[model samples]
Target: MRLDASAGGPSGAGLPARLVWLCVALAAGVAAIALGTATWALAQSPGPAPTTVGLALVCAAVASIAITAGAAACVHRLARAHVRTKASASAGQPVAGQQVEVYVGLARRLQGLVHREIQLLDVLEAQVEDPDLLKGLFQVDHLATRIRRYAENLAVVGGAVPRRQWSRPLPLVEVLRSAIAEVEQYARVRVVPPVEGTVRGHAGADVVHLLAELVENATAFAPPHTEVTVRARRVALGVAVEVDDRGLGMPHPEQDRVNALLADPGRVDVGDLLRDGRIGAWVVSALARRHGITVKLQSNVYGGLQAVVILPTPLLGDRPPARPPATEPGRMPSRGEPTGTATASSSMAGASPSPVGARHHPPAPPALTRAASPATAPAFRDAVASGQAPRDAGAAGPLLPRRTRQAHLAAPLTRGGPGPVNQPAGDHDPTLMADFLRGASSGSGEPPAVRAVPRH
Candidate 1:
């Protein structure tokens, strides 16, 4: 198969340049020898040998310059080829800009699919009131969120802007909570109190994406079940968010290398990231760069790596307008609110609003435990701790499952008619509605009893 010349693969272009340089070096060597001999002959004649020798010497100097230039060019070409060969070997594939485009395109397609999947899940969650089934849906929802993050990472690394944009600035704390919601081990993450600030609407999505990557990395690398704390504080440049874990810290040298990469991600080699499985680092770097944010890694008092992300003043914004209550005047807002507005859901659930990584939804009903199996035990535990469920084999299929809209069609049929089948229904309580309406009329619309039900 022919390799692409631009991909740093073996190419005839390099060969020609090297060959040309080698030929030039050889010719220069010959010319230098001939000039030296001529100079020697002029010196032997002893007839104004200085002038003759000077002319020969100048010619030899020119030839020497050619020899040096040619040799240097040949060596440089050889070195580049060697580096490319090693990189290809390490990555197990050619590292090229085209491959990056391919990945970016794939990521974009996956993003669309995942977005649709989340929408479908939102519909199912609204229709189904079975606590166990709802648990499964939440798990699927969280997983889809994680997948979306991965896709965003690829897009960002490929220089793709986030498609989702917020019309208004979001509270920095709300953004942090949304980020925690995207990680697999969100249960283990904690947020310090009083996260005060807001990110500009234009940069809000990218900032959230960047923080999610950092939080995800912290959660994954930290010891299982250990706490990963995320906190934000005012800084001279802007606001600095710190994600600190308690796992074994990296060596100073390794930490320095990572800090350097995060500081100037452009210097990173894609092949090295592929070889080392450091795509998360690259994603964080890319997002940070887009908004002029600064990211760094350092050892913390907890004896683990602390990732500090500094959002510059430009990306920061004044506090946004107060979020509306989950319950509108006469009706309730559907649970299908975009992930960016999840704070409204959180506030309605009576979850503490101070901590950024605090719970967004109420705890799952006990019925979720019934779907537990040896295979899903870990996910179940994570779900319980996080007030969310992990994907269950019994509840949903491998890749985001599409719940059949006409599920009744699957029921066995008898001679008279189909067997009785249970139908999904929204979690609604007539009494709760009456009370909510009464409170709304009285202009004191307190949360109602139905708030006990989890709404994602």
Candidate 2:
């Protein structure tokens, strides 16, 4: 990549200039040798030859000194260029016609470090509340170790340090929770699965980089009192981690911009957002890609933004085969069904009503076509009148059994063939209605004693 001269400056040009100077020195040395040899030849036939030879030697020394001085000047220039480059790269850019800014870059780097440190401390605090502080301490130590490792990696990239490997399994969830908790102190944020659990695979520094950026962005954009939730779920292909915030939702245009930035993983420039003093969303995108994960931003359920990172699953060598999906007590319903309902029709058939008011709508009748027996009619009528359907029915299927009972109840109220009576409207006691529907017959089998229906 050709770094812009104005951006990184002439730091890279130093080596070439030094090589040119070396060539000059070599040429000077050769010329001095030739001149000295000629002078020695001339002095051999004359008086005071040794003195002439000394003069030639002095000339050679002078040439050598001149070459050394030239080389020294080149070296000085190279050092200055190196310094300029370092200063330029670190200082970044200033607004048009303004003096180059140094504090901004330094402040950003410092802020990043401080934020990471605070996150580590929060994780440690979370661990302390546990009865087994040793485990907590281990987690804290692991996270701290990973952060240090990442810092070392950054230093190596900056040419200021060496590379190292993390031999022990790093506690990623601990570190991630810490990062989230640290941000939550000043920002409204919630970390899902706040407790410790192991995720498969070794993620290295990339996980930390992506999560930190995500949490930081969530904290920045979310409004006060708005919660930012970070959750991770293990999937068939991999683990999917989501950071959701309830704030001003990202507009479609901005979402598109974010997508474009993620498409090209190489670009680290946060662009205008950073330039305008806001942390660029691109930072999260770049880090996610580095870890072999795909990042996507979308509207969250609460009408805010969500940052999702899908990481590839790791293979466990020599491990036992994965177990089949076990049937849990509450099997979640299929996509089209209401949330949290069981999917199996048999389970729904025996399912009892929740405590009175707590009950959800009862399941619909089963698809059987048999006529309702006399014994079941009254029971069915009461269930329907109370807005409860039979359990044998499909939860979402037609209420055939209930409808049949309603027909029976309407028969008593209706004289002609079978239909609802056109009775006048009046405030009737609900209990009376229930009692009447419950088949409590007046001594005579006629309709129970009741007030005359009011005329419309």
lDDT string for model 1 (1-456, tens) is 000011121223345754644554454444445354543554476443344444544554454444433433332233234335556767897754554454456556656655665665555455545465456446656656765665565566566778777644456787898899877688899999767666777787788878887887787777897899999975545578999988888888777666777787546564454344454565676678788899988889988988898886446552222222333332212121112223343233222221111112112111232132222333334333533222122222232323332334322221123221221111111233433443343233234223234334
In terms of TM-score, which candidate is strongest? 1
For model 1, what is the error of residue 455's alpha carbon versus the real structure, in angstroms, after optimal superposition?
30
Q: What is the lDDT of residue 417 in candidate 2?
A: 21
* Candidate 1 backbone collisions, by pair: 139-389
Residue-level lDDT of model 2, residues 51-150, one tens digit each, is 4434443453454334433432332333233334444666894322111122222223423442344344444344334344334333333333333333
TM-score for each model: 0.50, 0.37
By summed lDDT, which 10 consecutive residues of candidate 1 come out lowest? 1-10
Candidate 2, residue 279: the lDDT equals: 25
> By TM-score, how accurate is candidate 1?
0.50
